[model samples]
Target: MHIRKDLSPGKQSLLTTGSFLIPLFLWTIVSYAPFIWHPDIKLQVSADRSGVTTVFTAGDRVSKEFFPTFSEAIRVENQAIMEAREQNKPIIGSRRDNLKKLRHLAPLAVANGWLEVKEQQNDEKLYGVWKGLAEGSLKSTEVELTEENIEVIRSNWRLLSAYAPTYDSKRYPTEAMLKLIPQGVSSNPVYLPAPHEVIQAGWRDFTTKPDNDMPTMWERYRHSLTIIFWGFTYSCLLGIPLAILCGSLDFFSKLHEPFIDFFRYMPAPTFSVLFVAFLGTSDAPKIMLVFVGTFFQLVLVIANTTRLLEKSLLEAAQTLGANRRQLLKRVIVPGILPNLYNDLRILLGWSWTWLVIAELIGEKTGLTGFIDTQGTRYNFDRVFPVIILIGFTGFFTDRFFHGLRDLLFPWTEEAQTGAKGPITRFILRMSNHSSYADRTKA
Candidate 1:
């Protein structure tokens, strides 16, 4: 088997930068020109609700007055219904008033190009029985417009709300338009908001915006980071020692290999319920989940890395009057340090994956929990930012650790070209200076 050396520094940087920037460019184009895959304009209808649910599109410029009009209309309608009940009068007058307000607002919105009406037969009200197919026949009660069906309908509404905005705008859309007046149709129409709108909603929902009772994004992230750190800590504590033992002793490798492989194949989520049952829905189970995800995998990786150390090096250390302990520490462990650091860096990412599931067990605190809640509410704008935050955080963290590895282990072949780069050297110099200053003060 031929081993490939690291790419030249210039080639590596070019490839890495291109890999990210090219996709980013394409994504931006897709976001602006969403019509390539899906329609540029779509009206999502909530089957249970009446009227136009939401306007979904990119590049729309909605007038500033649209939201105030929508709000005023809703307010007037609610107030009228309340007064009608108090006065023991029919709601016909209130209904007429609501209609009049909408009648006035609709044309203004349409004329301003904020709303577009797509003609539909019977006004796009979906009322067919959707049956599931089983054994080449339609199941009579596959699904219908029951409470369950209502949920399904809502899910469709949410799906559109979430999907459209993701590719709608490279930046954010400012359209605040209303469409398909719901006077005779339904109570609430689902609308695909612009990216900016979603981001603002996410900020409010995930931050300390006074009215928001949920934990801030920072709080959730801190909780998640805490879980990942502790889990990784435990995994490193147990895994490194076990791996060293396994690598040093053939018997230990044979003894634990099958067991490690067995659990490695077992998905981490399978143990979620068991972990919750044992540890309760607190942070303990989540931390355990991360530990389980990282530990066995790390042990195997470290063991393999340690096993690859040169036998001649070990023999030389032994010949130099080193004991078994010194040979293990000074030879085996040090030999694998660079690769081991890289392994831990990669495993830290897995810890994040497990973190998502772990946070779900108890009160939703992390970015994942925020996503779940916002997604259900069809507030996809909020969801996208948190998702982006995760990826963005992971990307930078990976780069930081990658650079740190080169800085710490300059002798490693992989570190040679990467560390010699101007950017890496600058960062390395800053880091070395910081360390030196700290030592001098101490």
Candidate 2:
């Protein structure tokens, strides 16, 4: 199809900007929208009732009596302040201090419906919300009260809980008493988050002083790239020649098909244990995993792509008095060049999918490895950036190959549609110069 080339500069710019910005806008909406869906943040305590914790995840059921009384909140705040002062520090902490300011802001939180409470308490009320938080029925993380929030709480306590009741903690069966705080309450549609959280978490981790010998994000990315580069290189070395032979010779094709097909269907992950056992805990197993994952499929694709060469071109070459060897080299290989390049480009992307799987088998030091470790700790903020990095790396790599292909095969129909970029022009000039020199030598 003839694509329109008459777009104005403004329209072109708009298209270019939209192509990038639209996805980012959509992604942001998806990531932040969950806060709207599950707006209620709740104060939880550890399963053992040692201390208070907070959960940001939405969907916790709040009971009518879930909110702590003004006295209980004050007691918690006093404990925090005492602890901070004992440590020769201010009453503030650096993490999860939203509730620390609660003493001062409790009244505001209650007035704004950020905090909810039931007016009457009864023995049979069965504090479902309180039990859930205390017994670990709900997923919970212990958060520290920030110094700023502590000051906010102490100063604002009177205004915060003006109407809060006095209650006895021992009277309730719940080991932990939890107060519900609304982050946002909406039934509206939204998107989930992992990437944004990952980037944020990763940045935090990067900035924080490391407690151990964990590799940085750049180091992990470098390791992943190293594995993929070598694995893909090895796969091409073994696969391409085999694929060419299979495509050119019927005996080879028939003989290899059964074994190739069987191995391809066997699945790469199944070999994870085997590879580790055989290759040990080094990078060899991971590289081999990538190779196994890409090699057979790549061979099959290339062979099929080679077979799709037009019969007319082969016949024409033969008609021009070309022998079998020359026809195979000068005709079949050349005929399949553009298609083979595209096939390899696509397979290169497929190779990346195996990276995480490969890295999982032996060493856990790459981007995927870090993601796997942090994911268990619910640190998706760290995980998200690595995933995005993988995408960006793949996108730019694909573009690089595409541009390189255009430069190498300017005569192909794919190359003719767009204006040649500087790289293509430069290569074309070099090519012309080399051809001119060859002619002069002859």
Candidate 3:
């Protein structure tokens, strides 16, 4: 007899560590590399200022402006240098020309000035610039050089000239500079939402409040789940029995085949619309939508399973002296059990997909309705989480039925036993030792 050698503890630990690290390394490379390399802009402040000046980033006190269009500002600065050099003397020129040129080149300076003056004065005159820009009153052609504008322009130029070397170097200020800047005078740094904000935004309020009596989030989830569950269940119940009857009886088979074929081609949504016309936008229409969507597929599955079972095993049972009822109970059902289970799984998945459409038009409460509401309100955060939840829930439910098939029909040679049978039994056994032992003994 040969004894199988298990992996040693140290080797196992090393293997597990490697396994975990490999994926982590891959995920880090795949998911985080881009974000690390190039961070996205969460907030943008485009100041219509005079010259290239200090800009504020989140958590940073004063960083140099990095606008692509700031080349015009540099050109103006170069022109100013050339003009001053051409004079060959400290020529005290009118500040208005430089100010106007600066304002044109870097409107961001104007915006920055406006922001600054707005902080000091509670007057409407201070807000006139921003309000004009926002309301589209200040066009590119109209350079309204007011007293307020000149003061803002002069102040911004001074600030930008002081910070010019830092801008050229692409270097941020020290902590000392950040601390020295007064509140509301320093640039306003916009903060993006933290992880907690993102999480909180994902939750939706669906329940009835004092102001409004609408369904809750839990209610919508429960309603959708119920619709999917019952729709598949009732479809299977009705379709499978009828299919079995039709397949077993030749006369019934001839009568039902054409009708089934007709309905299979007829679209469910069309029928749902008709049902809504008849039943109104009540629960009946919603339930009927799910039913119609699932029914045809269920019929096709059940009919095929019945036909196959009958052709293969029904004749065998009959040759072995089995009656009609006996054949159905023993041979027919047993032969078709795996196929039926497969059909059920397919229908369940289909039902989940269709339930969305069912709730979209007719139902008051469901995932589809919730998604629609969120979409109308522009709540993308809530929509994505619900969609993710639906996908994961469907995956787990399909896997569950696959596990169920293996557990109940293990005698079949081709039955799948993927991590579900022995593993599940082992876990259950650990939980209920006496019951497990009795089951094993039996």
Cα lDDT of model 1 by residue, 288-391, tens digit = 98999999999999899889889999999988999989998889988989988988899988888988887787666677887888788766667777887888
* Rank order (by lDDT, best first): 2, 1, 3
lDDT of 3 by residue, 1-442 (tens): 2378656667866886798689657634543344332233322222223333664322223322433334335445445544654676423323343333332323332344543522333223323443344345644332334343344334443433454432332321211110111111122222222323325655434333324676666777887888787777778778888877776677777888778788878778777778889999877777777888888778767777777864756677779999989987887778878888888888888888778888876554677786788777655556755675688789777866766675567675545323334445655566678865765565
What are the per-model numbers of colliding residue pairs?
10, 15, 14
* Prediction 1 global C-alpha lDDT: 0.61
Which stretch of 10 consecutive residues in model 2 shows the poorest summed lDDT? 172-181
Tens-digit lDDT string for candidate 2 (182-243): 32223222223434555666688666655588776677789999999999999999998889
- Give the distance in Å from residue 123's predicted Cα in candidate 3 to where it truly belongs: 12
Instruction: Give the CA lDDT, 0 to 100, for residue 402 in model 2.
Output: 80
lDDT of each: 0.61, 0.63, 0.57
lDDT of candidate 1 at residue 126, scale 0 to 100: 13
Give the lowest summed-lDDT range of ten residues in model 1. 123-132
What is the Å distance of residue 296 in model 1 from its true position? 0.9
